[model samples]
Target chain A: MAPQPKHLSGDKAAINEFLDQFDVFLLDCDGVLWSGDNLFPGTVETLELLRSKGKQVVFVTNNSTKSRADYQKKLTSMGIPSSVDEIFASAYSSAIYISRILKVPPPRNKVYVLGESGIETELKSEGIEFIGGTDPSYRRDITPEDYKGIADGSLLDDNVGIVLAGLDFHVNYLKLSHAYHYLARGAKFLATNTDSTLPSNHTFFPGAGSISIPLINMTGQQPTALGKPSQAMMDSIEGKFQFDRKRTCMVGDRLDTDIRFGIEGKLGGTLAVLTGVSKKEEWDAEGAPVIPAFYVEKLSDLMG
Target chain B: MAPQPKHLSGDKAAINEFLDQFDVFLLDCDGVLWSGDNLFPGTVETLELLRSKGKQVVFVTNNSTKSRADYQKKLTSMGIPSSVDEIFASAYSSAIYISRILKVPPPRNKVYVLGESGIETELKSEGIEFIGGTDPSYRRDITPEDYKGIADGSLLDDNVGIVLAGLDFHVNYLKLSHAYHYLARGAKFLATNTDSTLPSNHTFFPGAGSISIPLINMTGQQPTALGKPSQAMMDSIEGKFQFDRKRTCMVGDRLDTDIRFGIEGKLGGTLAVLTGVSKKEEWDAEGAPVIPAFYVEKLSDLMG
Candidate 1:
């Protein structure tokens, strides 16, 4: 059985000690600060508490539907001040991986996107050439003749060396078919994240990872997932911020991604909040996959 | 390692002996008889040989894009005369499963389809009500306001009891999102077939199974597959035709679906043809999952 986390709902001394233990605090959005658009009371004050204590805060998110600037705008609109640099969204991670890491060269340097504007925005900010996302030309349904064309490679752009997948609101079979053909022709497959469901409006919906399920199912190959719990994204975060692992703490509502991200990265601590996908019983269960260092009823409980 | 099958090429006596072994010939259409629109040289003759010998021929296909009548028409066009009743398509199996077995009571009797018109036609023929497949209203992209509607159950049809998925050319996030919400609302998930790839135009494309991949990823539930390799489909075929399992022979070009279906159904024998997705080297590998009883260079080789 995994060890129990210290429930610090009313323990002022333990909470204070916890606050003093970390110089850097990595927080997950969505569930921790808000449930969809309804921001929890004292959520901003909770972040302020971390910041007022001289802690470096990075808003780590797996949502690939929005770029770093878009996320910053969302945060600002929600009354939580944030900057693009402090945001490490999966789309941004994928963008950096494509630009600075993969370095796909000329003629075949363009990317075929199977996602929404956020991924496109991130790639644009990185000055990367891309196609297919929100493009009207690729929005139409695939025809029977298209299959023959796809098979014959006549309906494809030869310059697309990589296929970037993310959460796409307008995702359809047309984009999927083109992406499948490109991958079959030796294009690299990359995904912003593989988080199957997106939590929004106090409910779960299909996430960015679900968009790539068909390709993964068809190709029998998994794409490079640059999201939370992936060490690649963690390495990117560490490189960008240069934070000491021993003095950094992770806080989030989900265990599989946020908590796992912290634990696997060998961070100082992981704090689980109850307003999200996971609960205390999950970590308390026998032979639990992950156990956080501390538990709070909600982020507002940190004020106590 | 599995024992290799008898190479039944250039052996007239062996071919005749094999031909006389079964009363019913279960043939896979796409790979064994034809590749896409281009029919093999002796496909009609091959079927004629089985028929002349008083053997029952059933066209068992995993394609859900066309109805049994449509398949019969395609066969007629190819000069291989076929009856609608002699076809056991995945869409037909799913319809029968819904109309006969599940028998979902009214108010929740209507099914939401995430497939092509074939599934719609089969469901219509079976006197089952279904919505969403090729519906102009369901073809639009989901907007931001749609999320709240999806969560609160305002955007969903309350009468939807099942979500039948198959090969859909117009598959989009709109249909998938609605299907996810319906599945979350306790709708039974059903798939025509889970064949990962479709053999078409002498190449492979995303199969009906790929249409359900996103839903499977989101729901974390495997839909009841009413297609090839599922014993339910085998039972449906047996109940419809009354063919003795011991006197039934399965012939196909794929190992995973056709051969596995025959082997698992305890059919008399399985013959592997070289004109399809699987190769002879597959069953020849160490500890091969399935090995056919015999192999022929092509379906025409049965004349040897």
Candidate 2:
């Protein structure tokens, strides 16, 4: 059954009571914090208020385009104080899952990445040596005749142990061929997230799921996704912060990712904010897979 | 139930009787005709003999990398005289399905091709205008920052009515982004073939399916595949040759594509030759989805 979310009024007493129930808050970035480059009103004040009340705030984002430090910088630039420790981006989570959880070391444990420099940065920071990511060799497009050499496996690295895929703008057959060869030969498959589309400038475009799908189809293997609403990301947060799952609430705009992330992780509660993907009709609609435990006009509704 | 194939010995009378039953022959190129660059022994002779016996032979191949003319030339150079009319490649079938069958014409019917020059060539031959395939603009790999312009739909052609994908050597993010945009905007998604891997020089590499999977995943839509084992190609053949289905026989080395193609099309008969991917054990495996109506050690085994 879908979670029945209590529609909280803009009543200050009720909002304070609701906020009192959770010691920690897991927040989604794109929709709740800001839409594209524009920040929503009361976002910083709400975060500051939560922190002043001793409530821990963890930023959980499925955007694999940026590293944790990059997100921290972006958040700080937006007048919201965010440190790397409080940020849990999918790219960093993927790196942590691969290096720490999977224990994939350098050299033989080399990863073939099909993503941006964010993934590269995280992997490098974790001391996980990888190839095919942001590499100039794979950037050039070739004709059908040129594929003969690639298909011959002459140019592929022999030591790809894991294939980590994310939101790649340069996804080409060269990287795909190498990933296919490795996966077919029993290499581990990993993905930062499987978000079908990403919201940018109030429009949705193909997300990391687009990059990972081809690999999934070719290899006939599903990847171990390291982003919301995957359990791995929640586990990563739990491992690092030691936050009590029962006292932590997830707040976001998307039902499938944020609310589902909280539900799948068995968190304290999930709050759906309006200012993003899901609408009131959708929440009111019957048979939704992931209904939030609470509904508010926006994340900053508590600020009033 | 799997079709029970009658195993034929090298008996001349039985072979001749089996051959006489079918007025038309549909042959798979890769395995039945040749393995990579080397033709199986007696393949050319078998085709010649079939022609001499007044049996019509149609080359049906799932390999979308080469155009019909290319295949015809390859066959001619290899001592097998094949006309372009007798060749039904997946590339040609995709073009036919998009242009003639689907009736997507020029201007607003512009197709975004995600394959090699073969698909481009076939589409061009059919007077179907397309973009992205073999285009120098789409072949360059870019960083995540580069995707911003692509994702914003600045680089995409607005008149894309169909996104046709096949075996692409230059499969890259730029093409995928455009395809994704088009598909998300309700463009028809079509695939030349959904074969996962292509065999080349004793090695297997990522095939057309690898290129299409990302689109499939991103759009949550399965493409209408125009290749072997699909009724679309058979329909195309029927439209062209008016061959009697009951009097037609499919000869292939693989049970999945060749035999299944015949089964799906309900052709006169399906013959499995053991000169390619499937072994005798596989053909004889219990509960196989696609068992040929007849089996031979090789096409040459019936040539005595």
Candidate 3:
């Protein structure tokens, strides 16, 4: 039962009053802070204002395509100073949680990584053997045939303990087929997120989330998503930030993922920004169950 | 609850005795008469025997991919003689039912077809103007870009009265995009079936039913399905074949489509065949609420 858009006015005073109650802010990166390279208006001043008020702020992104180091660098280049500790990507969460679940000594089990270099690098840092179709030199395009070979046991001489699916654009038939094979053979299937489509430029493109569905259907197995909206990610954030759920707030633009995470995590308040993903008219037409506590045109409107 | 497989002991006399009471046999094709190109063993003989015994046999295939004429040719080539009148494909049902619903004279309104040429041919014969894209040359490869252009109003200029989706292997991004655009713009979206997969060789391929989902998700509009298991198809069969529901039975192999159709249509009975999609072990493991009346390994088992 999300609040009606009419209830969330664009008044600066109302928006600031809503933000004043929360001590910690968890923000989504892609749709809320920035669309791609360009940062959303008033993002920097908003964070500065929050920090000035002694409130904690952390950036959380579900894009498992990149590592925290990369995100940190990118944010710095965009004039938004962020530390490696302040950034949480789904890839990092997946690596940490999956490693803990296996409980195997470092470098013992081989992981079939169907994702970006960030995932591969993370596994390597954790002493796990990472195997994927794409070469490390030019990791952009991995053919479906490579994926098929890995899935059908042509590539693996030993048993794989995990199959990690993250963000990749070149995902095709062979990859999906191979992923299904390994998944059916009892390998743990881990998906980074469940956002079917990601915003790109002016249009929408199929994201890693959409690619995981075919394999999920074929295997008849639900992959454990190690990303935002999952309880694990929320716990990880709360544990690291040392923030009480009742005093923290999640602010994002998407209803299905961002707002859903807020409601499911039982955060103090959920805020919906009108700057991305969903439009006011569409929100009014199809109301969601997870209502935002406040609405704002930009995060900069938040005060101490 | 579907009939127990243990009841079918491969005894011919027992199977025949069970089927004798039914006046009409409505059979589904894909998983019943044949899977892919090969007809299930003894299927033709069983239909012939049933017809010889004055038990009306009608081939009811939900494969909207082909026309009645195509089915007639395919069946005749398989040594099973059947007229177009005795064969009902979903495409024919959709055209007829939709035409009546729209109250348009046959062949008057232009239909944008996103299916096989069989559907286009049927609509054309009935005087409907085929608008979108049609290759009478029987070219099998049509890109999603072609369909996207049609759906986005880039390829065609005429007002499309209906958009029909069937099985197309060349289904791609553009086709789905265009279909969604046209559907969102108030064009009627009529789907061929709701089956998630279609039998292909010994494996399964994504069917038109699965392909329709993304479009449905994007537009948030429910398209009328014109295939088996739908009440409309059942009603059409009953009206055309003059089969009494209290005495007629649906004989097919697939539990979800065939047996469910019988239960939903309120047919007298359902005969689950082990030679097709469902196996005896599955029937035994998880019981169905609308049980089949009998179970047989093959169609000829009923001819004793």
All DockQ scores? 0.76, 0.54, 0.09
Model 1 global lDDT (CA atoms, 0 to 1): 0.89
Shift of residue A221 alpha carbon in model 2, Å: 1.2
lDDT of 2 by residue, B127-210 (tens): 888888887876665555546666676766778889988998877666776788889888898899999887875677778888
TM-score of chain A of 1: 0.95
Off by over 4 Å in 1: none
TM-scores of the models, in the order given = 0.97, 0.94, 0.73
Q: Residue A114 CA error for candidate 1 (Å)?
A: 1.1
* DockQ, Cα level, model 1: 0.76
Per residue, candidate 1 scores C-alpha lDDT tens digits across A182-291 of 98889999999998888777777888888888899989878998999887788878878999999998999989999999999999999999998898889878899999
The models' CA-based lDDT, in order, is 0.89, 0.84, 0.69
TM for chain B in all models? 0.95, 0.95, 0.84
Q: Clashes in model 1: which pairs?
A: none
Residues B160-273, model 3: lDDT tens digits = 657777765434344454555566566777887766655653554456665565565555677788787777788767657778897888888877778888879988788887
Per-residue lDDT tens digits for candidate 3, residues A96-140, read: 766665454534356667776777666665566666635443232
Can you tell me the CAPRI class of model 2? medium
